[model samples]
Target: MKVIDTVLNVLWLLLCGIWMALGYFLAGIVCCIFIITIPFGIASFRIAGYVLWPFGRTTVERPDAGAPSCVGNVIWLVFAGWWLVLAHIATAIALAVTIIGIPFAWANLKLIPISLMPLGREVVSTDEKFGGR
Candidate 1:
């Protein structure tokens, strides 16, 4: 499974991961430019790494996340999250048109929620059970 993940990740990187990760990185940099949004910038950078090599990993909700996270996510959705969601959706649609790209398209769709609400989520290896943190 690890080897398969490696292969898929390499292919994904070649096909679209690099571009998606760059978009996240750009968003991070933009967010970091303002003093108030450093946390959102950090989340963007973290998600950028996940976008780069996503095959063997998954995102899980943090048990301790509370109302603050919800509020932050709402803010994110308004400012930047919607753009990321649209990018993922567009990428998915394009990938879905090719039979060989079906799995990648599915993966892109799976990423929408996390991209939309990155606050209070943790990225973990798929080997780790949710809440194992």
Candidate 2:
């Protein structure tokens, strides 16, 4: 399973991951340029990492997150989130057109939510034990 995941991830990177990640990276840079939106910038960078290597990992909502995350998500949506979502959707469609790219397309679709609301999400490797460090 690990080997398969690695192979899929590699293919994903070649097909669409790099382009999606680049979109996130560019958004992060722009968000960081403004002092008030720095938090959103940080979130963009976090999602960038996830999009870069989505297989073998998952993103979960943070149990302790509260109003701040909600508010931040709104701001993110207004400023950059929509753009990322569009990019992910577009890439997903393009990848889905070919039989070989179906898995990568699904991965790209899975990323849309995080791209839209990056705040208060945590990425965890699927193979890691629940209580392990």
Candidate 3:
């Protein structure tokens, strides 16, 4: 990655990474406390990485070639994805209400489409995949 790309990715990872991790952590704790919910918790943990670094991730209709699929992924959407999407939507609405916050609100809204369907998305860098110049 170029210096600029590297720095931006780093900053993105930092800003959202911790928030994602915390969400997953709480989800995990909930699952652990109730053994029946462990599966859902684990699913949230998987999503946390994508949530944190969504900038580099791309969601596609199909997998690249061969990728693992899980039975719990759907459940994940039901339990966790909705919450994340709601949070972002609420944030977007709140920010849009203010002129100064319009930019931030736009950023939050940008996350919606991808956040809704994160499956099959690729997380890659310009140097690592098709993004290279």
Candidate 4:
């Protein structure tokens, strides 16, 4: 990751990433309680890691991921995703209130879509944009 991305990520982790990741972790735990929801649980955990230090990473649709992921995402959204989205929005509002936190607030808003539909997405390094992984 670039120096700027690293700095932004560290700041984000301090200001909002920890709380957002915790939200995802809690959602993952809930999803894991049932056998049928294990996939959603896994996806939630994956998203949790991405939320932790998000500045240098971006989410892309996985070409090989199929219908099951879509179905799981719907179930996830109905069950726990909405609450996480609300949390993100609330956090964004709080962060936006401070000048220093404005960038983090934007990052928080960027996470809402993934919070709502995490399946079928893979987090890749921004360096991949330059043909390197």
Off by over 4 Å in 4: none
**Candidate 3 ranges beyond 4 A from true positions:** 1-21, 28-43, 53-71, 97-104, 119-122, 126-133
In the range 106-130, model 1's lDDT, one tens digit per residue, is: 9989989999999999999988954
TM-score, predicted candidate 3 vs. hidden true structure: 0.54
> What tens-digit string does per-residue lDDT give for candidate 3 at 57-133?
44444455234434344555676667778877776676688786675467567766545545545445434466556
Query: RMSD per prediction, one decimal?
Result: 1.8, 1.7, 4.6, 1.3
Model 2 over residues 35-83: C-alpha lDDT tens digits? 9988887888888888888888888889999999999899889889898
- Write down the TM-score of every candidate: 0.95, 0.93, 0.54, 0.94
lDDT of 4 by residue, 51-76 (tens): 99898888989999899889888988
Model 1 vs. true fold: TM: 0.95
Model 1 ranges with Cα > 4 A deviation: 130-133
lDDT, model 4, position 38: 85
The CA lDDT of each predicted structure is 0.93, 0.85, 0.58, 0.90
Candidate 1: clashing pairs of residues: none
Ranking under TM-score, best-scoring first? 1, 4, 2, 3
